[model samples]
Target: MARKPDTDKRIAVLGLGRFGGSLALELMRQRWEVIGVDANPAVVQGYADQLTHAAVANTTEETALRQLGITDLTHAVVGIGTDLEAGILTTSLLADLGVANIWAKAVSRQHARILERVGAHNVVLPEHEMGERVAHLVTGHILNFIEFEDDYALVKTRAPAEATDRTLADSELRTRYGVTVVSIKRPGENFTYATAGTTLYAGDILIVAGRTRDVEAFASLG
Candidate 1:
C-alpha cells in the first residue's frame, strides 16, 4: 500500500465541510499531522484546537493555496462536496502542486469524472458506496462484503451447518457452489490461509472471493 512521506507524514485537507472536517479529525486521531483549510472562517475556527493547523483560505485560488503551504503536504483530500467547480479547481491545483496522494469526493458520477480528469489520484462517491454496502448488509446473508472492480467481491461469512466438520476438499465448493475459500477465521484466532486439508467447523468464518453472485450463492450455503 502507498503511504505518505516517511520523514514528515503530514496531510492537508482542503474544505471544512462535514466530510472534510470528519476526515481531518480522524487523521489527527490517528497521530497524523493535519493542516485543515477552508474558505469559511467559522469552519476553520471550529476545528482550530483539534487540528495541527486550521486556516481559512480559498483552495480554489492558487495564490491563497501557495501562501498556506499547500504544496508542502504530500497527501491531501479535496472534499469540497457542495461546489463541483471548487472541487475541480482544488483537485487541479493540488495536482499541479505535485501532491502525491489526492483523494477527492464527488456528489455524482459526472462530478467524480471531472475530478478524476482534473488529476485527482482517487475519486470517491461516499453516499453511493455506503448505500451499496448497506444493501448487502441488510440481506443478512454474508457477514461482510468488500466490492472490487465490476461485481466481484471478497466476503467473510460463516460456514453453513451442513458443510461443517469436513475438509475443504470434501465440501466441493468450487464444483458445487462455484466459490473459493481464501482463508478461515476461527473465533479468537488469526486467519489461516485455506488449504485442501483445512476443515470447516460449525461457526467457522470463511474469507471468500469471487463474483458478487457467486459469493451470495456460497453464503447461501451457511
Candidate 2:
C-alpha cells in the first residue's frame, strides 16, 4: 500500500552532506518528520536511524523521486553541494512535481540565479552568509547579527555607555541613532522587552534593530 503523505511538519532533504545532514538532524530535533535522501548508500545508512526515513536514490531522476514518494511532500530542500547539475536537476524536478516550498543551496551567484530561474522558491548561500556574519562579529561589538533585505538588520550587542543609566526614551536611540533597542538582558535575569520607561544598566545585552549602517554606528558607540 502507498503511504499517505503527511503534509504537516514533514520535509524531505536531498543530499546528505554536511549541510543537508546538519539540517535534517536539526529538523528532527524540532520534532519534524524528515525524509533524508542521498545518492550514496553509506551516507543514507549513517542517517537511517536518526531520520524518520532515509533512502539511497538519485534525486536528479524524476522516477527515483517518484518511487520515494517525493511528489507527495510539500516541502523539500536540495542541499546538494558542488554538483551544480544535480542540484539544478533536482530542483527542477521538485518544481515540476509541484512541491509548494523548494529551498536549494547555491555555490555562487550564478548558481543562485539559475536555481531561481529553474524554480527554487528559496536559495541559500550558506558559506557566503556565514562569512559575512563572521566579518560583522569580528570587526564590531556585535555578538550576533541577522541581516534582512534593504540593508536592515537585527543585532545583539552590549548596551552602549550612553544608553546605560538612562531610560529608552531618554536615550533617544530611535531618533538620534535611527536604531531601536527591542529587548535587553541583564547579567543574571532573562531578556525583557524594552519599553520607553525601561532603564538600561551597564553590561546589559541589547537586541537592536535598524539599518545596517545605523546599527553598526550604534554598536560602535562608547
Best by lDDT: 2
lDDT of each prediction vs. the true structure? 0.87, 0.92
lDDT, candidate 2, at 4: 37
In terms of lDDT, the poorest run of 10 residues in model 1 is 1-10
For 6-78, candidate 1 gives per-residue lDDT tens digits of 2567988998898899999999999999999998898899999999999998888889888888777788899
Off by over 4 Å in 2: 1-7
Pairs clashing within candidate 2? none
Model 2 — which ten-residue stretch has the worst lDDT? 1-10
TM-score of each: 0.90, 0.94
Q: Write the per-residue lDDT of candidate 2 for residues 128-218, one digit (tens) a residue.
A: 9999899989976989999997999999999988788999999899999999999999999999999999999898999999999999898
lDDT of 2 at 135: 93
- Give the poorly placed runs of model 1, Cα more than 4 Å off: 1-8, 188-190
